[model samples]
Target: MDKKTENFLGIDVGGTHVKIGLVDTKGQILQFAKEITASLRENPLGFNLAFVEVVGKYLAKFPEVQHVGIGLPGLVSKDRTTTLEIPAISELNGFDLKSALLEKYPNTIFHLENDASAAAVGELHFGTGQTSQDYLFITLGTGIGSALILDGEVFKGVRGNAMEMGHMLSRGNSRLEPLIGRNGILKIAARMMDTFPEEVGQLAGQELGMHVLVGAASAGNSIALKTFAEVGEILGEAIVSTVRILDVNEIYFGGGISAALPYIMPSLDKTVHQYLSPYYLSDIKMQRATLENDAGTLGAAALCFMD
Candidate 1:
């Protein structure tokens, strides 16, 4: 196949698995595969070496692919040449990943980026009717990941790793992530059940999870509704501050927890409107991202288009 028309390889490196996809210019994934990181924890060559080797295998398997983009879950060097602090995969910390990959695959072009930023870039190209050049992208999953898109590009604040919303302090001086993240949301559900035992309904005495919480909310369970309300309030407050600093009006939410946007919207909207002035609230456009589950993979592939 002609290199000009060839597919690009996208690699989304997560804590547990590495999602690989063959993507085209239109953002459609032509092929996909996954590798479990857990199995490589004890590899004799070490996780870093094993990961590069796995990538090499994919490169060999798809000989037509000449461009590769990698989206990593944590901090990357300012120049996008190294993995700085990947909490989930400590083995990659301080590793010169870009150099290693280039050494092994000398003929290929590689682009490395923070996962959240990559997702924003992906949205820029693949999002449904998302033509806005300025917007804030937030991913709500194990942790809250964020990115800022300015002038059709991911804004890497002075340090390359700009939007770190997870660490932002919120109510009670606690970081935002632990308050509304998966475990935090579950904690709220559990607490709501204890506080309103009679109104708990489907959530009463059940194993707590995002699915259960969303299902209960869908079923009109009071406890579940209350849990989401709290989550929305906290998340919204953070957004208010973020918006104030960045002056961004368009916001996109993605990730697994975004599934409960309907339930959280009431509180989220209230909080934002209550805190922001008329100017900030008037033209605000907040909505869920069109590419939910595939954002990471597609976003990684989208990196190939960036300078």
Candidate 2:
């Protein structure tokens, strides 16, 4: 058997569904499946048990796989053996997930990590063009997610879960997520449309969403442009603080909402350059991440490469 072609399992645990992929060392997904988590969440046996049971089913089906990587959405123990807190699935809090999986599959090696951090690892390994081993990764989606890569590894702070930029306090002491996340951006768009009805263009009398906002922005709608500008300013302010603390120059943005980056760039760049000094601004590199929808699955598999 070709050891290099050995299959590995990647599991991305989310609130609504769990995405599973059979990936090889080169990052190609050979097989994929998704399990809606509503039933698992409602199961009387509890989410932890239901989750384990589902994974076992996959393991039984892919008996040749001995390595499994699970990417979780919230906080995890520094030792990476237990889930400290998972907001989407509260039952996982303080659960010794590693032990549970081990009890069921004694011969397999299991790896766990924060989902955002896992994405960063995937980018480091699979991204194009001399991807930085050290960079700040930000995912703009339903919520803002962040991770720091230092010396080719996820930078876990003293407490384990580090680089949580979303929770950072921003304007008026509001959390960063509420100020610039998906909902936050939509709120800005609505307010802009309301403020400048004549400039609303395609957004006039329409249901607002990220896609609509991006589409309008692409079509040069004044309201859409204004909304993204505001979001960029707020997000850029947060990045300024993050860059100052972490001292990382290469920044990569990903996720569904990052599509608005072009619209947000004017204010984002202005805010970043306005506050940062010459030394910090000189080498700064910020751009969109290459991996898109596949990032989560690829990231889960990337966990197996971590020490």
Top lDDT prediction, candidate number? 1
Off by over 4 Å in 2: 1-3
lDDT of each: 0.91, 0.89
Please state the error at residue 10 of candidate 1 in Å: 0.6
- Candidate 2 lDDT trough over 10 residues, lowest sum: 1-10
At residue 23, candidate 1 shows an lDDT of 93
Per-residue lDDT over 1-307 for candidate 1, one digit per residue giving the tens place of the 0 to 100 score: 3544768899999998999999998888999999998877678999899999999999999998888989998999999999999999999999999999999999999999999999988999888855599999999999999999999988889988899999999999999999999999999988877788889776666778889889989999899899999999999999999999999999999999999999998999999999999999888998999889999999999898887
Q: List clash counts for every candidate, in order.
A: 0, 0
Residue 155 of model 1 has an lDDT of: 89
* Model 1 clashing residue pairs (backbone): none
What are the C-alpha RMSDs, in order, of all predicted structures? 1.4, 1.3
Question: What does candidate 2 score on TM?
Answer: 0.97
lDDT of 1 at 116: 93
Model 2 sits at a Cα RMSD from the real structure of 1.3
- Which lDDT tens digits does candidate 2 get at residues 1-307? 3437788888999998899998888888999999988889888888899999988999998998888889999999999999998999899999999999999889989999999998888888767645778999999998899999999998999999998999999999999998888999998888887788889877877789889889999998899999999998999999999999999899999888889899998999999999999989987998988888888988888888777
